[model samples]
Target: MAYDEGLAQRLREALGDLPDVVEKRMFGGLACMWRGNMLVGVMGDDLIARVGPDGMADALKQPGARVFDFTGRPMKGWVVVAGEAVGEDADLADWIDRARDYVEPMPPK
Candidate 1:
C-alpha cells in the first residue's frame, strides 16, 4: 500500500526541527517518531496518530478523525485523520501534539 506523499511532506514539515525525531518507513507508509515512539504517520491519504488510549475520545471528536482499525481491530488511543481535515497546518500540528503528549513519556524503543 502506498502512502500519501503529499501528506507525508506536510508531516515532515510539521515535525521538523523537533528533537529526537526519526523518519521511518512503516506499514507501507511514512512514520515519524518522537523519542522512539510513533508520533504520527501517513497511510494512503490518511494521517495516523498515537494519542494514547486516554486521548482517543477527544481526538475522535475532531473533524475527519476516526479510530484507527487498519487490521480489523480497533486500536485504542490511535486515530486516522482524513487528509482533507488536515490541509491546514494548524490541524496537522495539533494531531502531532496529541500524539507527542502520549509518547513523550514512554521509554524510547
Candidate 2:
C-alpha cells in the first residue's frame, strides 16, 4: 500500500532541523532515518516507529497503536501508530521521538 503523503510531509517538517536525517523508501512508504538507522516512517496512513524491544509493550498500550505487522508475522520492537492517533503534530512528533530515542544511539547501518 502507498504511504500517506501528508503524513510524510509532516514527518519531514518535524525532522527538518535535525541533523543526519535521511529519507528512504521502505515498506511501501517513506522512511526517515537518523544516522542511517530507521527512526520512523509512514505506512499507509499509519506511523511506523521502531521503539526498540524495551519500549514496544508500552508503545502498544497507547491508543491506536499496534504491532507493525507488514508481513504475516509481527515484528517485535516496531509499532504502527494509526492515523487517528497521530492527527496532531505533537502526537506525531512524540511517536517519532520514541523511534529516534531508540535508533539514534545505535551505530549507523
Candidate 3:
C-alpha cells in the first residue's frame, strides 16, 4: 500500500512550528527531517520513528507499536505505529518528540 498523503500533510502541519523541517520521499512514504536528520516518516498507514537504540525496547511496549521491517529483518531502533494511534492520542507526541530529540543532537554539516 502507498503512504497516505493526507496523514503526511497532518504530520507536516503538526511540525510546522519547527524551523528547518523538511519532508522528503522515502521508504515508500514521506520522511520528516530536522536539521538534515531524519526523525519520523509516514509509511502506508503507519508512522515510522527513529527512536535510537536506547529507547527501542521501551517504545516497542506501546500499543500498536512494532518493529519496522521494510526489507526482511526488523530494525532495532525503529518502530512502526498505526496512524490511528497517533491521530487519536496526544501521547503519540512523546514518540515523535523522542525521535526529534535523538536527531536534533547530531552535528549538522
Model 3 backbone overlap count: 0
- TM-score-superior candidate, 1 or 3: 1
The true-versus-predicted C-alpha distance at residue 8 of model 3, in Å, is 0.7
lDDT of 2 at 16: 95
Query: Where does candidate 2 clash, by residue pair?
Result: none
Show where candidate 1 strays beyond 4 Å.
none
lDDT of 2 by residue, 50-87 (tens): 99999998998998999888888999899999998999
Task: Quote the lDDT for 52 in model 3.
Answer: 85
Clashing pairs in 3: none
Best by TM-score: 2
Estimate every model's Cα lDDT from 0 to 1. 0.90, 0.90, 0.84
Whole-model alpha-carbon lDDT for candidate 1? 0.90
TM-score of model number 2 = 0.95
Off by over 4 Å in 2: none
